[model samples]
Target: MGKAASALDYRELARRRLPHFLFEYVDGGSYGEVTLRRNIADLEAVALRQRVLNNVSEIDLSTELFGQRIRLPVGLGPIGLAGLTARRGEVQAARAAEAAGVPFCLSTVSACPLAEVAAGVTKPFWFQLYMIRDRVFMRDLMQTARGLDCSALIFTVDMPVPGSRYRDQRSGLAGAPGVLGDMRRVWQALKRPSWAWDVGIHGRPHQLGNAVPVLGNDSGLNDYFAWMSSNFDPTVTWKDLDFIRSEWNGPLIIKGILDPEDAHDAARLGADGIIVSNHGGRQLDGVQSTAVALGPIAEAVGDQLTVMADGGVRSGLDVVRLLALGAKTVLLGRAWAYALGSDGQRGVAHLLQLIEAEMRVAMALTGTTRIADLDRSKLVSAEAGANNRAAALA
Candidate 1:
């Protein structure tokens, strides 16, 4: 059999297809991207034992989450402005996620309106909130989500103030580029004629789906983002979470948690689950990688709340590392975005299938027949001071 395709192959294709600003916004991380590098390094350091002569016939990948049977344990985490990646980006992503038997989360800053996206897809997708300062506006957004019959609301408590993503500032992502920069960006757009012809010219306008009357019939795209940033809530706290609980009754998930203490706080606030994330290393630069922090948070509050994790998850092997450490499910940020930017709906579907296929092989090599059988025992702690931590130490 020929060699399985590498993620870099897909990434390279995506890079070539996307405009410079959009690609950098999705790919770049905060500060020096130290946390980003650490996220991958820590996961790669984990060693799984490959057993020999094991009967590996049937593989069961199905798992239940929030009363839904997911084909795989991975789900698409909400990313802002995903629609910019492709035409009707949120709708395409949701449809692809649903087709793959997984839940697609719509962001507060998505391109399509909530009703429009809900109308476009048949499946009940999750909605993410970027809580703003205006209480009335927030209420209307929640009401809209409820009216649409959304399955869950993932309250992203991470970005009260947007991260200092230097890359984005450098790339002029926030608004219209300067004269020379605008010309360069347009030139970059021409390089990907398909994206320009399909999305840029013929597709529906990209507008935030969840923003209600504020963005209602906004005159231009610049006004939309200006309104979003100006009104985003900066004083959000644990008590604000309580207020959210009072408003929305569907399964409530608190995303943007990195510390175990915060995880405990979220569970105590009646959170059904907590996504242990550093916002994909987008928010904090010096923070501990989410992969490294997943174990402690899981051990701390795994019983109280469903523990999920995300950050630097580039391959199926990374998923195995996260699960072995104690994550019930994992979220992919750039993985799906890359697919959307490069090949539209089919690309995202193919990417999910590829990850599922890789999970099967990883499980087989480790002599596990089911995803539930994956445990810490299957993993030997990385060689510690030249000692066999898995065999020699306890």
Candidate 2:
């Protein structure tokens, strides 16, 4: 409602605008959320070197991703059930991303179907896939993406099974609920009158669009969740990628990679890119943060594949921090979702502009002219800080 200067501001607004269950679904992480907290903490711990007297009149934020030049090095990562956040939220987000000159990735469980989103936006958006048990469904989805002229296929490999997000259970969004729990959820939704009108009443066909062919159009939210939990194939392995590659000839990116071995394997598997992520601390609680895991994975396979990351990217400074650490580009999951939940497409567009402006200021202050020029040199090492402290003591 008020001026949202940062992503946190939008987050607060989103929390107020959305129902408790939906807000918690976007905000909460799995189990203890140790990795979730660590994601932001480690990014804050990264110190950028400051420079002065360097000409920073013009700062270029443009970069090429999968051969297309984008306005910024940021992409809106996939978020499932985004349509529930607002009226056709995924379509709004895609339109905003298109207007911002960046890519918007649509989730497999998105509220808006891929074909619908494709029709909504002028340019093609990226598609994120979850490897379910049915190979037929997966192949059909790939063909659909190709038919929609999707730019990239981001294969998410982290969620073998859904993680235990206590907040979801508490908010009555995840697990099967009793009569009282359903009543409480209904009450919560009733409290948000504007949301109730926009998403609950007008936003019809609450069914998962993409899953309709496999799960049936008559399926409800509970059925969709049950299907997702039952279908995420635990037997998925590197060899499974061969099947995906055989079906689609577009740029393939393996998401949810934290280890160097996995990055190596992704490159060997002919993946065009690898996203260093821990599913935004949703799938795995105690795993390493993307910021902490990005450097090693990037160093290992960056030359062979595009190294990107996502987690705790709340600001443009965080984006620059990721780039300095070796991420060619960064993805924003909750940040954009928060904006979408708060103010629909306008919030997302403003957030993108805010991040881009912050990145330019950060680049100017850090004496970096081009995004490609960013490296470890722009960051102050811990060892260097320790040595400086010791020298000062002496």
Candidate 3:
């Protein structure tokens, strides 16, 4: 088989495979997408100080999160309606993650059932949770994940309400009509002949796997949406964290922490780890990029819990940037989705290979032998100075 190239290769391929509506849902950001643009720009600004004539042997990218060992320090982040991107997108993505020796996190809103994905991958993976008001429903969801042998539970604290993705509105995929565009997304779907043939004709177009039992098939997509809007336990408090901790009995990671204080709070609340993320600029607009906040958050509570960050992570070099800032792992949200959209399982696997190759090449260039050897000293940008401040704050 021919070798795959870059993340952009996968992205462009996905653009070709998925319909315009589905692509926008995964690719677009909220409001003006200022945060989205910044996430990529800020990450790019941190340049790696390459060194020469150093012993670069055995570029080990393996990392241990909670208790599970992964091949790399990057894992696929949760994406809602991932299946809509491709035929059974979550399963395909999970299979790719398994092939790469990293964890694939399934969203609470994914189309494939949790157990089915687990059965597809033939290994333990991480499950992302969106706490709901219904105790019985939440318990069942947790039980399903547990039965599937998921190693950890990532409780997403963000996404209490969906963000206003103007691109999705423009793509004709969104629920509401916006001043920016019209809702005739069906025409765009007609244009994507591949999707209408593969995704639209072959299987279920869009369905929330977790909500199937609750709303039942008669409920349909509209009912699923209504149930989720009403069901998610948005009034979630720290005390609720304790409740989740009691239930899962696994590594409980609290995602969506932007502030150092909250990172510390996640540690105090019995969280096994905390992901410093801004929901990929999909939630609040004009927020500080996760990369900008990572170093500080890592410094504040790095010793207490695992420090991971996600937002605008496009390449392996960005992985190094995050590691320098104190992130043990970097979550790939759009990158994985981009892969899924492009060529389904093959596309995702190719993207993972590219990232790993990029990271190994980067390690050789930086004259570093191991991931732990990387630190602030390698980065000359002002962000490194900010990371230092985050450490001081802690």
The prediction achieving the highest TM-score against the true structure is: 2
Candidate closest to the true structure, highest lDDT: 2
RMSD, one per candidate, in order: 3.1, 1.3, 4.7
Worst 10 residues of 3 by lDDT: 176-185
Tens-digit per-residue lDDT, 257-374, candidate 1: 9888899999888999989888887877889888778888999998898888888888888888789889889998898898888778877888898888889899999988887887
Q: Give the Cα-based TM-score of candidate 3 against the true structure.
A: 0.92
Clash totals for all candidate models: 3, 0, 4
What shift in Å separates residue 276 of candidate 2 from its native position after superposition?
0.2
lDDT of 2 by residue, 1-394 (tens): 7768999899999999999989999999999999999999999999999999999999999999999999999999999898788898899999999999999999999999999999999999999999999999999999999999999999999998988889988888867545666677778889999988988888878878899998787766677678877999999999999899999999999999999999999999899998999988898889999888988888888899999999999999999999999999999999999999999999999999999999999999999999999999999998998898799999
| RMSD versus native structure for model 2 | 1.3
Report the C-alpha displacement of residue 105, candidate 2, in angstroms.
Answer: 0.4
**Candidate 3 residue-wise lDDT, 47-157, digit = tens:** 778799988877888878777778899999888888777787898999999989888899988888787787798889888988788877888889988987888899999
Model 1, residue pairs in steric clash: 111-207, 113-209, 132-233
TM of each candidate vs. truth = 0.93, 0.98, 0.92
Of the candidates numbered 2 and 3, which has the greater TM-score value?
2
